[model samples]
Target: MSEKIRSQFGCSKMMLPEHCSMLREQALAEYRAENNRFPETDEQLREEQQYILDEARAGGKTVIIKTLNSNGCNHYMGIPLRCDSTGNKIIIRTETGPDLSISAAEVVSLTIAD
Candidate 1:
């Protein structure tokens, strides 16, 4: 029922709810690959983020934080360095290059793996 409504909307730019809904699926796949399980709730996602932040502060962990691309799509990989004061930006160490600073609004998910 709801699945039909969701797939019907897809990622059309005009349908914000559909975009938001699909983001969950993206986050789920990332979470599963990183943790070997799917998050059961919003709290689980938050806990995962906190765990990544703590691990990042501790250093030497591979972290993948999803930030929206220029086209407003999400999928990225990097090491979390830290977030700036406004909470709207973060610095990340990229897989093949230098650090990158991206907007907090652009970040849709977090995945930390060994």
Candidate 2:
């Protein structure tokens, strides 16, 4: 098997450590067979993104999001409180230490840093 395929299936020698190569290959093949698809529309894309976000929230990870100004400077940083689909932005409780709330129109990026 190719190195790329091996790595994708977590079948690398480093990952296996104790498991046999054949066992790793079987596990990887099962995983690949279970999940294989390409989103065909914007709605599908949004669903996938929401699934990821939901998983992150359920995992108890701190979701930090940053909002940038027109000049590309970071204008806000905080823990995302919730996403408002109608408003198309996230409601964040600012980390600036005084219980401030803000609506971030554009999320530059999200980090699930534990």
Candidate 3:
């Protein structure tokens, strides 16, 4: 059977994974709301996220983010941030400083990393 046919048959037999489906839907919704297009893959999501991050950084905005490191002692001086493609979430480096670190659940409020 063709790959498309196999996917269709297999999809009917199992539920879509929640994370994948949610990311797909979010991508579609954002596309529709902005450019009336749909993201076809996770790579597209990464591209979008990078674009936004670059734009913000270029504009010299101070971004808020959730730290991936659970321990708050790691140095983030030279590492780049990571972002979720479909969601408005970014990972930042947190060190022993007075800067505020958000939780992953509160990532929507991130602005730009300073």
- In order, candidate lDDTs are 0.68, 0.54, 0.47
Off by over 4 Å in 2: 1-52, 75-78, 94-105
**Ranking of all predicted structures according to TM-score, beginning with the best and ending with the worst:** 1, 2, 3
Model 3 per-residue lDDT at 79 = 26
> Considering only N, C-alpha and C atoms within 3 Å, which residue pairs clash in candidate 1?
88-104
The residue-by-residue lDDT of candidate 2 on 25-110, one tens digit each, is 89998876555322233555456545655666566445655444433434544455567777676555555564334433444445
Which candidate would rank higher by TM-score, 2 or 3?
Answer: 2
Model 2, poorest ten-residue lDDT window? Answer: 33-42
Candidate 3 residue lDDT tens string, 1-114: 887787977656655599779989999988756653222335554465466657655564544433333233222231225555456444444444443333333322223455
Candidate 2 lDDT (Cα, whole model)? 0.54
| Higher-lDDT candidate of 1 and 2 | 1
Question: Candidate 1 on 24-74: residue-level lDDT in tens?
Answer: 989988875665432343666666676776787578677776655445455
Top TM-score hit: 1
Q: Is candidate 1 or candidate 3 better by lDDT?
A: 1
List per-candidate RMSD values in Å.
Answer: 13.2, 15.2, 15.5
Q: After superposition, which runs of candidate 1 have C-alpha atoms over 4 Å from their true positions? A: 1-47
RMSD of 3: 15.5
